[model samples]
Target: MTASRTTSAPSVDRLAPWGFAAFVEANTHDTAYRPPVVDGPVGPTIVRGGRELVNFASISFLDLERHLPVRRYFAEGALAHGLSTSGSRMTQGICRPHHVLEQTIARHTGKERAISFATGLLANIGFVHAMSSAAHFDAGIEVRNRDTVFVVDRDVHWSIWKGLEGLGYGRNVHAFRHNDVTDLARILGRDRSRKTVVIAESLYSADGTMGPIVEILDACDRHGAISMIDDANGFMVYGPENRPYAREAAAIRERADFVMVSLSKAVGLEGGAIAGPAAAVDAFELLSGTSMFTAAIQPPTAYAAERTIDVLAGTPEIVDDYLAHAARLRRQMHEAGTPTLPTESYMLSVPIGNDAVALQMREWFVEDGYLVPVFSYPAVARNQALLRLFPHAGHTEEQLDGFLRTLATYRQRLGL
Candidate 1:
C-alpha cells in the first residue's frame, strides 16, 4: 500500500484576499456599527450597556411586548406548543393555534379568509407571486390576458418588488409617484387593456407618510384593476380612534382585493398575514412558494398574536392610548420646531437630509439615554436620511419630554 501524502487545506485568510470574501471584508467598514446589545424583551425601555435606555428604536407601537397579559400568553403558548414548528404548513407544521390566528385575522380584517406566513416580507413575496402567476390565474379566476401589469407605488417596501421579480414580472412593474393618486391614475390609464394590479402601502415606513388608499382603490375599481394594500405599518395604528379597520377609509377596505399586514409591529409578535377572498387565499395557501417551502410560524408566536388581537379588541383603550401618545409626540415635536414628515401613523420621520448628520444625531440621542434608529440610503433615497421615532403607549411623559428636549438641543447645535 502506498502511503498517502499529507497536505494542509488553504486557510480562509488566503481566500479572503479575493472574490466575494474580499469584497465583503472591504465593505464592512462602510456599514453602520452593530447596535448596542439588549438584555431583555424590546419595549419602551431597553437595557443596554448596563443602563436602561428609553427605546424609540422599537416598532412595538402599543408596547405590547412588555404587557403582562401578552407575556403570560407567550409563556403559556411556549409551554403548550414547545419552541418550533419543525416543518412547513404543507407538512406537519399546521396547528390549532395557527388556524385560530388565521380565523382571528380574517375576522379582524373583514376578509373572507386569511393566511399566515413566517414574516411580513415573506407574506408579501408569497402573496404577490401567487397573484401574478399563471397557475393562480388558471386555478379559476378570470383574467383578461396572460400579460399582467403591476402598477405599484414607487415607495412601497422592497419586498413587493422582490415578489414581482420572483414571478418574472419585474419588467411589467410600473411605479407611480409616492402617495400621489393622480400619478397612479395616469399610470392606470396608460394601460387599460392589460390585467393590472395596483399596489400601495397603507403607511410608508421610511418617510412615515400615508398613501391616499381610498383614492387608489377607487382608481383601481374604475380601471378594472386589482388593489393590493400593504398595511404592515398602518394595520394596527391607523383606523377609527386607533382601532383596526376603523380608519376614515374603513368603508373602502372591502374594495381592496388584497391586504397584507405584519404582526411584529403594533401587535408585538412575530408573523405576517394576507387577507383576501376565500378562493384567492385558499389558492395562495396551496400555490405560493413560501407557503410550500418556509416553515410555519412558531406556535407560540401565533398564540401570542391571537391573544393580542383579543386583548386589543376587549381593551380598545390600549389602542386609544397608543394613538394618543403618538399624537402628543408629534404635537410636541412640531411645537419644538422639529416637526416630522407629514404622517398619520405612529412613526415620525425627522429628515436630516445628510447621512453624516443623521448618524451623529443618533449617537447624541444614544448618549443621552435614548435609542432611535437612523434610516439612511436604500431605506430612503440618497441624501434623505432621517431619524425615525416610534412613539409607544408605554412611554412616560418625562421620557417623551426628555427626548424632545434633547432633539431640540441637537437641532440647535447641529444647525439642522
Candidate 2:
C-alpha cells in the first residue's frame, strides 16, 4: 500500500467477491467460475452457490464480529437508532455515538483528543491536507507550508500520496527505502533546517510487513521531525497495554505526534480516526475539506465500535491463539518451500511473482473449495502479485491443514 502510483488497471477475472459479467469479460479471457454471492455470516467456512468453502479472505483476525455480544450490541443499536447520520458532522453536529467512540479511542491510545472520519483513506488524506496547508494557524508550528518537508516511507498507503497531490512541493518530498532506518536517517540528516514530517504505517496491509516503529521515532526525534503512524492495522491489534503483540505498545502513543486507527479493522466496524493533541484534532476537524464535506459514520456502527474496543481488550487470548495459528502456518509454508512475505502480523502473503500463475493458483484454490485472494497489477508491482491469505481464529485445525496441503500441491505443480 506504499504511497506509490499504479498506472495499470486491476486484474478483475475473479478478484471481486461478486459476479460482474461485463467486468469479467472486459478485463480478462478466463472462463473460470465467477465469484459467487456469499450467504449468512462470514467465518471459517463460507456458504456460496450451494457449496461450503474454507474462507481465507476476511481481515477480522479475532473474529469479534461473529461474537454473540458484538452482534447483540450492533443489532440492538441499529434497532434503537435508524441508519444514516443524515448530514456531515460539521453541518448536522456530532451525535452521542460518535462522541463516545471518539472518547474510547482517545483513552485507549493515550491521546488528549481523537477525531473520527468515514474511512481510513479519508483520514490520511485529511491529516496530510490539514497539516500541510498554510491557511491553518500552526502550519508546521509557524513554518510555511512550502518550507515544511514531507519525508515518507517508500511504501505507505496511496491515500497519503493523494493528499500531497498539487501541493507544489515537487523535490521537497523525500522517500526512504521501506523499513530502512539508515535511508531514513540519511534523508532526515541532509537538511536539518527544514521542518520535516515522517509518515509511515505501523503495519502494512498488503504483504503484512511491519515498519520499524521505535527506530522511526528515534530518527524523527534527532531531526526535529514530526511523526505520524498509520496504525490502521496496529491500533487495537498492537499498540496498547492489553494488545496481543508489541511489548512496547504503550510507548507508541506517547512518542508519536499523530496516531491513526481504523474502526473497520480491530474495532470490527466502519470508519477511521486520528488520535493526538486536542488542538491538532480540533483544527483537523474544522479545516480538512475531506472531513468537513463527507458524511459521518452511522450511529449503530459507531456504538458497536465503541463496545468492540472493550470486548477486544477483555479477550487477548483470542488474538494470542490466532497469532499462534498464523505462526504455525508460516512455518509450515516455509517447510513446504512456499515462503511468505516479511510479516510478523497475521497477514500472510505468498508471492507467485507472475500474474498468469497467480490467477491459475487462485483457480486451483477455488477448485479445492477455498476463496483465496490474488493481488496483481495496480495493487502490487506488475508481475509481482501474490496470494493474500487471512487465517481466522474460528478456523478449525482440519480446515487449516487442508489449506496447507493445497499450497504444497500448488508449489510442486508450478515448479517454482
Candidate 3:
C-alpha cells in the first residue's frame, strides 16, 4: 500500500480503574445472565423477544395494567396531563391529579394525610430523613441529639439503611434480629431514655415473611418509641377478611405512628406515599429532601394511581380472588414436595441455597416458557439464594399447573 494508517488500541486504564473494570468483566462472564427485555405489559404471561412466557417475576399482583378500564384511564390521563409534571411539587409541579391521588391514598389507607413520592425507595428514604431530623431542617434545632436512637429490624430494606446514612445517623442506628420481637424488646429496654424510632416492614419481599407488626408496635409503645411500618409489599394485598391488613388493619392504623406504601405493586401504578398523622405528613411535604429537590411523580402516574384506588374500593372481591389464587398455589407447591416459606401474603420464596444452581434453574425456567427470577448473594446471604414467585389475580389454574410440572421436572437438577 502506498499509504498506511496506524491506530493505537484504546487504553483500559483511561477507561476505568483496574479494579472496577475487572469486576465488570468478571460479572459479564458470571453464570447468571441479566434479565431480558419485555415488549408489553407485565402480567401472568409476558412477551419477551416475540415469545410468550409464563411470567412470575412481575410485582403487578392484580394485573390491573392489562385491565381494559385501567388502561383506558391511563390513556385518558396521559392525554389530559401531557407527559411530565416538569417540576417539584413545592414549586411548579403541584397539579390536580396529584391532589386527587394523595386524597385517595390517604382515604384508602385510613391515614390522616398522605404525601406521594416518585417511587417507594424515595418515599422510604425521604420519610426517614425528614422524620428523624425534622427539628434540624425546620427550626435549626438538632432533634437527633446524642440521646436519639434508631432501632431498626435487621431485615429491613436497604432503603432504610440509606436513609439513616444520608442523615449521618448511621452510627446511632441499631439493628435487632429479623422479626424477633423479643430481641427488639431487649434492645429497646437497654436505652429507654433515648428517643427511639423503630423501623420494620409489614411483609419482607425477599424471604416471603410477615413481621409481627402488632407485637413490634406494642413494644415500641411500652418503651416510649415511635414505630414505622414499610408496607410496600403488604398494602392492598393483605387485610381484614383478606383485604389489606390481614384483619388487623384497624390496629395497625391506630398503633403505627407512620406507614409507607408503594403504588407500583398491588395498586398497579408507579408512585409511593407516606401515610400518618397530618402533622408528620405536612412536615415531610415541607422538609423532606427528596420531595423538595426531585420532580413530583408524573401527572399520568398520579391519575392512574387515583383510578386504581377507585377500582380496588369498588371491587373488594378482586383482593379476595388474588389471595385465593396465592393460597392455592402455595398448597399445590407444598403437596408436590416443593419447599416454600410460610407467608401471609402472595409472595412465595423457595430457598435454593446455591448461587450457581439458582442461576442455572432460572435459565431452565425461561427455556421452558416460564420467567421466574432468582435472588442470589449480595441480595441475600452468601448461600441463601431463592427462587421468588409472585402469584397474581390474573394467573389461571392451568398456568399454575404447568409451572409446577416444569418445576417438578427440574427439581432434582436444582437440588430442591
Ranking of models by lDDT: 3, 2, 1
Q: What does candidate 3's lDDT look like per residue over 231-252, in tens digits?
A: 8987776665545455445556
Q: Count backbone overlaps in model 2.
A: 3
Mark the 10 consecutive residues where model 2 has the least summed lDDT.
Answer: 239-248
lDDT of each: 0.80, 0.80, 0.81
How many residue pairs clash in all the candidates, one count each? Answer: 2, 3, 7
TM-score of 1: 0.88
Weakest 10 consecutive residues of candidate 3 by summed lDDT: 28-37
Note the residue pairs that clash in candidate 2.
Answer: 2-155, 2-156, 3-156
Question: How displaced is residue 116 in candidate 2, in Å?
Answer: 0.3
Candidate 2 structure quality by residue, lDDT tens digits, 209-269: 8888889999889988989989998877775444344653655777988888888776667
lDDT of 1: 0.80
Q: How does model 3 fare in lDDT?
A: 0.81
Give all TM-scores, in the order shown. 0.88, 0.86, 0.90
lDDT winner among the candidates?
A: 3
